[model samples]
Target: MKAIANALIVTIASASSALAASGAAADEGGFLAPLFLAFGAAIIAFQAIPAVMLLGSMVKGFFSKKAEAGANAR
Candidate 1:
């Protein structure tokens, strides 16, 4: 069962890669490519804000816990 699952995943990956390789054409919408790239970058930048906030909160919580533990030991 695991062998069959692995084979299926490999087949799907190769088929998709082949399809993607054939689909690209040099003459197809050069201007739209940069616009789409900028849009994707903007989306990533917008999503990063929450991730940064979460990391900051996690660091703050970690330090507070250490401080509390030290106070209790004294």
Candidate 2:
């Protein structure tokens, strides 16, 4: 549990720093700025969304299988 807590802290810190740096970079640009930022965001979201969806499906599958097996034994 403590390890998990530490991991969460580190993830939060890293994400904050990364976002701060990206924000600073974006602010330095002119016209085409929002477009580039949106492109980068879309790429990141595309990658993250599929993995999140897969994780959710896996968790749901695990419980469904467990329930089915339990019901079969009864």
Candidate 3:
């Protein structure tokens, strides 16, 4: 448990430093700014695919239950 706690603290500290470094990049005046923006946009676009699939699956499940119930009644 003590080792796990130490590891967690180290991970958090390193992550915070990395975030600070990324923030510093913005102050350097447009070096690869467009590339970073495009990367961020692409990340968001890729994430949307799984979300849409989950929504479609949920809708399919909902209607399939209704269809099954209707057929069973007949």
Candidate 4:
């Protein structure tokens, strides 16, 4: 649990730093600025997929176990 909390803190810090850097770069307004911004947004969006999937699986497992236990009791 402590390890997970540390990892979460690190991830948030890293993401905040990347976003700050990206915002600074975006203000420069070159040809590639929009492209880079879009790419960064895409990367963040893609990263969420696995996290969502893992959370979904955990919720499903928890409910399924409860359902089975209720059925067994009946």
Candidate 5:
């Protein structure tokens, strides 16, 4: 229990002493960040349409009967 209390105190002290950089020291992703993010989102959206259609057809096929088998055998 004493070791646990010491560890907790150390954690609290380290957390309080940590600070973020001020002003010019901050990191930036530059002007192209939003453009890259938008492009990625658009790519995902375009890919999703075909994926949804394919999944829908697959699910429909699973629940559907193979009635065409008998007709084709004729």
Candidate 6:
């Protein structure tokens, strides 16, 4: 899907940039590594949060009142 592809692209780019920044900063200041690390983590979390919500909604639907009502109506 397009969303998966976009996530992959973003993850790859973020990882690459983080690595680059980390290496550059290691030679001078150590601050950028943590910043880039946080950036990469945030990117991954953003990508995963939607999927987690969607899966939670799907699981909730299986136990929901609406599902019971629909089953009774059938």
Choose the strongest candidate by TM-score.
Answer: 5
Model 5: lowest-lDDT 10 consecutive positions:
17-26
Per-residue alpha-carbon lDDT of candidate 3 for residues 22-73, written as tens digits (9 for 90 to 100):
6655565566978898999999999999999999999988887354566668
- Candidate achieving the largest lDDT: 1
User: Which regions of candidate 6 are displaced past 4 Å?
Assistant: 1-29, 64-74
By TM-score, the candidates rank as 5, 1, 3, 4, 2, 6
lDDT for each residue of candidate 5 in 1-74, tens digit (9 for 90 to 100) = 99999999999887765643235556577879889999999999999999999999999999987776667784
Q: For model 4, which pairs clash?
A: none
How high is each candidate's TM-score?
0.49, 0.41, 0.47, 0.46, 0.56, 0.38
Worst 10 residues of 3 by lDDT: 22-31
Those runs of model 3 whose alpha carbons end farther than 4 Å from true positions after fitting are: 1-28, 66-74
Pairs in clash, predicted candidate 1: none
**Deviation (Å) of 69 in candidate 3:** 11
Displacement of residue 73 (Cα, Å) in model 1 is 20
Model 4, stretches more than 4 Å misplaced? 1-28, 66-74
* Stretch of 10 with least lDDT, candidate 1: 65-74
Task: Please give the RMSD to the true structure for each candidate, in Å.
Answer: 10.8, 16.8, 10.7, 17.6, 4.5, 17.1
* lDDT (Cα, 0-100) at 14 in candidate 3: 90
Candidate 5: list runs displaced more than 4 Å: 1-25, 68-70
lDDT of each: 0.88, 0.85, 0.86, 0.86, 0.86, 0.85
Q: What is the lDDT of residue 6 in candidate 1?
A: 100
Q: What TM-score does model 3 achieve against the real structure?
A: 0.47
List ranges where model 1 is wrong by over 4 Å. 1-28, 66-74
